[model samples]
Target chain A: MSTRLDFFIDRMVSQRACLDFGIAQTADMQGPVFELGLGNGRTYHHMQHNIKGRDLYVFERAVASHPDSTPPEELTILGDVRETLPAALTRFGATASLIHADLGGHNRAKNDAFAQLISPLVEPLLAVGGLMVSSDRMYFEALTEMPLPPEAVEGRCFIYRRDS
Target chain B: MSTRLDFFIDRMVSQRACLDFGIAQTADMQGPVFELGLGNGRTYHHMQHNIKGRDLYVFERAVASHPDSTPPEELTILGDVRETLPAALTRFGATASLIHADLGGHNRAKNDAFAQLISPLVEPLLAVGGLMVSSDRMYFEALTEMPLPPEAVEGRCFIYRRDS
Candidate 1:
C-alpha cells in the first residue's frame, strides 16, 4: 500500500479497532464475510485467521504483496473486480453475506462509480442477514445537520439485508 | 412536532426511501421501527399506518404537535436527546437495531452533537447483527483524486481492514 493508502487504511483500522472493542463488549460474531478490493493480503490474513472457517473471498485489482502468503484454497485474488467479480462468483458458486468495501479515498468520482458498480453485486452476494461495511467519509464530507442528534459518521458501513 | 421537525423528518424519510431503492433495494414495509427525532408527527402519520408498529420519539426543544393524535403507547416525547436518550432506552426496554438520522440542514452544531451522542449507542442498541444505514452525502462533499485507479479503492477497504 502507498503512503496515502496506508494512511487511509490506518484510519480504517482504528475504526475497526473501535468496532472490535464494541463487538467484543457485545460479543456477537456471526458473519459469513466477503471483502472487496483486498490489497497485498494483509486484512485477508487477519480475518481468515480471526474468523476461522467463516468463508472468505478476496477480490483485488492487482496482486502485489503476499500473493503466495494467502491460503491458496480459501483465498481468491482477481485482477479486476469490475470484470472478474461476476466470473469469480460463478466459479466459486457462492455470493458473500458480508461485503466490506474500503475503496473510497481522495477520488470522489471513482469512489461513487465504484460504489454504483458493486452495488448491483451486493444484492445478489449479500445473504439475507448479511451487512456491507464502508466508511461514511467515502460517501459525504459531513453528516447532515438538520436531523439533530446526528448518527454514526466515521467508518460508516451500510448493512443491507435481502429481506427487512 | 413543529414545522421545523416535520421538515426534518420529511427529509429523513426521503433519504430512507432512496436507500430502499438505490441502495438496499428492499421493498418497504410496516414494522415496529423507531424514528429518533419524530418532528411534528407529520412524517409519523405518513408512515405510521404503513409500518406495523410505529414508534416515534421526539427530543425537540419545544412542544411536539398532535400529541393527542400520537398513539400514547407508541409515541414518546422528550425535551432533549442528551438528557433523555438513556432514559428513553430504558423506558422503551429495547435498543433500536435499525436507526435513521439525517444529521444535516439548519442545525449543524446540534446535528454534529447528536451524531456524537448516538455514535456510542449504535453498537449497544443495534441487534447483534442489525444494520445502521445513512446517506453518503452526509460525509463527503466529493471524492478525492488518488494515484491509483478507481478499482484501487476497493482493495483499500480490505487492506485497511487487515492493517488496522
Candidate 2:
C-alpha cells in the first residue's frame, strides 16, 4: 500500500501534469480560465505564469493564500462555489477555456459526494474544446472524460473535454 | 521512502504522461516519431493510437515483443541503438518531432552512464520545438529541460524540448 506521502505527491504531480496539458491544448482558444477553489492559490499562481493574455477568475469563500500567490480582488469571486459557480455561468456564459478544481476535503466519501454535487454546476461553464481538470472524478453530462496525460495517476487527477 | 512498487508505478505513469504531452505539442509539427526501445512495444502501441499522420520508427536490436505489439519490418530499424541512432541522424537529418527513449537496465549507475552516452546522439535529431522524452536524465548541449507536468514524479520521467 502506498503511504500518505505518496498519495499527496501523486495528487500534486498529477495536478501539475494535467493542468499543463490543458493549458497547452487551450493556448489558441479564446476564453478566460477559471479556478474553482483558491486554497493556497498554488495552482492559480502556476497558471498565471504559464498562461498569457487571458483573464483568470478565482472562486473561493475567502482569501487565505500566501501573499505572493493571491489572486487580485477584481478577479476573485468570493462565496461558496455552489453559489458562485452558477453566478459565474450567468456573468461569463459558457466560455471558460479551462476550469480547474481541487475543492475536496480529506475524507474520500465526502469528497466524492461533493464532486457529484458540483459536477453539473461546473459542466456548463466549459466552452466547446475547453478542458476541465479536477482532483476528483466529476460527473458531467456533456464533457467527455479525456485520457490522462502520461505521469498522471489514474484516479488522482481527471481531465474532461467539452467536444461539442 | 517509497516502495519498489511505488517507484515502478511512478516511472510508468510519468512515461505515459510525458509521451502524451510530447505528442500533443508536436501534433502540428512536420516530422516522424522515433521510439528508441521497443521492449514489449507497450509504449509504441500507445503512441500509435494517439499519434495521427506521422510515421513512427522503432529502434531495436531484435524483435522480442508480443506479436500483437510488434512493428512491421519496414518501420523497425534493427541493430543496437548506439549504432542505429547515429545512422538515423544521417538518414533522417534533424527532423524528428518526438523521440522517446527508455533504454536503461535495472542498474542505476549503468542507466545513468547509458543516458550520458546516448544524450549527445539524441540531441541532434530533434527538430526545433520537438520534444525528447526519456526515462533517464540526459546531458544535452542545446535542448532545454522542461518542467514536468503535474502528477509526473520528479526525476522519474524527463522531457527536453529543442527551443531553437
Candidate 3:
C-alpha cells in the first residue's frame, strides 16, 4: 500500500475517538448514505457495523485491486469520485441523506472539485431533516472562504440538514 | 505568550490538518503521551484547538463552571485545560516532546487514570527511529490495542537522532 494510504488507515484505527464522535453525531439520522473518497472501505465498514440495513454508495478514485474478492453487499463501489459521483446519484435516483467525505488535507484541487460537485447536490440528496456530514478539514476550507460565520466551520464533520 | 506557547497557538489556527494528524499521534506512542478522558476543558478547547505544549494538562473530571476571575499565574486551575495544562506541567517540572489526547469521545476509566496521568512522563518519548505524521481514523484506533506489528506503523515527523 502507498504511504498515504497506510497513513490514512493507521489514522482510522488509532483515532477511534474522532470516528466514534462523527458516527454518534449522525447515528440517529436516516440513511441511503454516500461516502466520498472511500479508502480501502474501512469507514464504509465502520458505518455498516454501526448502522445496519442502510443502503451505502462508496465513491473511490480507483477501483479496489481485488474486486469480487470480498464484496460487501450493501456497498456499491463507484470508481473515481470526480467522474462517478453524478452517475452514482442518478443510479440511486435520489440525493444522499448522509454524504461523508474526507478528501480535504493534501489534494487541494481535487478536494475543491469534489466540494463543488457535491454542493449543488446537498439540498436535493438530503431528506427532510437528513444530514450531510463531511470531514472538517475539507469542508471547513470551502466554508471559510465563503462568507459564513465561525460557528459554521467548527467541527471535524459538518452536518447539513434538509428541511423539506 | 512564550514562543513555545505561540507555536502551539499558530498550529491550532492555521495547521489543523497537521495538528489533527501529526501532533495527536505523538501522545499515542508508548512514551509520555497518553489519551485523557472527557472533561469540560476538552469540550471547549483542547479537542477543538488541538493545542499541545509542555505546560498543558487536562482534568479528567468535569467542573460545573469557570471561576469569576482567573487565578494567579502560578496557581493552576483544574477545569480550564487550555490554561491549566501549561501551568500544571510547568509547575511539576514535567516536559513532553509530544502530547496527544482526544478527550472528546468515550471517556473510559483506563484511559483517564493510567494513560493520561502517567503517560506524559515516559522517557525518550518517541521510539528510536520512529516518525510522527498525521493519519486517518482506522489506523488511529488500531494502535490502542497492544502488540502492534512492526510493519503497521511508519512515517517520520521529527527524526530523533542522537549525536554519535
Candidate 4:
C-alpha cells in the first residue's frame, strides 16, 4: 500500500485518469455526472470544472464540505448512500455517464462490505460505456478495467468502463 | 526525469490535475481549451471527454495523430505554433480558459527556449482565472504554480493557474 499522501494523491490521479479515459470512450456521450460520495465536496468541485457540461448529483449523509464546496440543494441527494442510492435510480434513471465513487475510508473490511451494497444500486444508473472511478475495488458484471493513467498504482485507484 | 512510461503517465496525470484545479478556480468562465502542442491528439481527445462544453482549438505542425484521434478541421490550427499562435489572437482574441502545453522532448534546452517563446503569446489568451498545464518550467508573469497533484514528480507536470 502507498503512504497516506500517496493514497490521497492516487485517488485524485486515478479519478482524473478515469475521466480522461472515459472521455475517450464516450466523446459523444451526453449524460449527467454522478457522485457516490460528496466527502468534502472538494473533489466534487474539482469534477465540475474538469469534467464540464454535465449535471452533477451528489449522495451524502450530510453536507460536510467546506461552505465553498457545498453543492446546491437540487444537486444534493441527502441521506446515507445505502438509502439515497436507490432513490437515485428512480430520479436520475440510467443516465449517469461518469461516476466518481469515493466512498470507503480507512476501514478496509467495512468499506468492502459497504461497497458491495452500494455498487448494485449505482451500477444501474451508469450508461453503457460510462466510467466508474472508485477508491475501493468493486466488480460489476458489466464493467471492465480500463487502462490507468500514468502513476496510478494497480488495485489502488480502480477504473472500470461499464460495457453491457 | 522519469522513464518513458512514467513520462507518458505524468503528462496525462498532471494535465488532469490542472484541468481539475482550473475548473475549481473558474466555474463560470466560458472560453475555449487551448493546446500548444497537439502531439498524437490523445490528450486533446481526453480533454474533449473529460472537459465538456468547451471549444478546443489545437495548434499542431502537421497531421500526425492516428486518424481516430484527429480533431475536426475547424478545431485544428495547423502551422508553426509561434507563427500560427499570433494569428490565433486575431481569431480567438484572448479567450482561452485552459491551456495544455505538452511540448519538449529529448532536447530539454531547445524545448525550454520554445516554451519561453510561446508562453507570452499563449498566456495572454488565457482568462484571469484560467489554467495552464505544461511539461516544462516556463513561467508566465500572470500565472502561478498551482499545487502539484499527488505523485506528480516536481518539474515533470507543471500546473499553472492564470491569475490576472
Best by lDDT: 2
Candidate 3 has a TM-score of: 0.39
Sliding window of 10 residues with minimal summed lDDT for model 2 chain A: A1-10
Evaluated on CA atoms against the true complex, candidate 2 attains a DockQ of 0.02
List the candidate 3 regions with Cα displacement exceeding 4 Å.
A1-31, A64-74, A108-110, A136-155, B1-164
TM-score of each: 0.37, 0.51, 0.39, 0.49
Q: Which numbered prediction scores highest in DockQ against the true structure?
A: 3
Candidate 4 has which clashing residue pairs, if any?
A150-B9
Off by over 4 Å in 1: A1-10, A13-32, A66-74, A88-95, A136-159, A162-164, B1-164
Residues B23-100, model 1: lDDT tens digits: 121123222244455544543443344333434343443545455335454355545555565665666544443444
- lDDT (tens digit, per residue) of candidate 4 on B1-164: 22232344565556556655655555566888887777766666666665667787888888787564678999888899878888988887777888878877657789889888888877777777787888787758878877886745666677777666
lDDT of 1 by residue, A39-66 (tens): 5454455555545446666776765546
Which structure is stronger by lDDT: 1 or 4?
Answer: 4
Worst 10 residues of 1 chain B by lDDT: B155-164
When 1 and 4 are scored with TM-score, the better candidate is 4
Report the C-alpha displacement of residue B55, candidate 2, in angstroms. 58
Model 2 accuracy (lDDT, Cα)? 0.87
CAPRI level of candidate 4: incorrect
Per-prediction TM-score, chain B alone: 0.50, 0.98, 0.25, 0.87
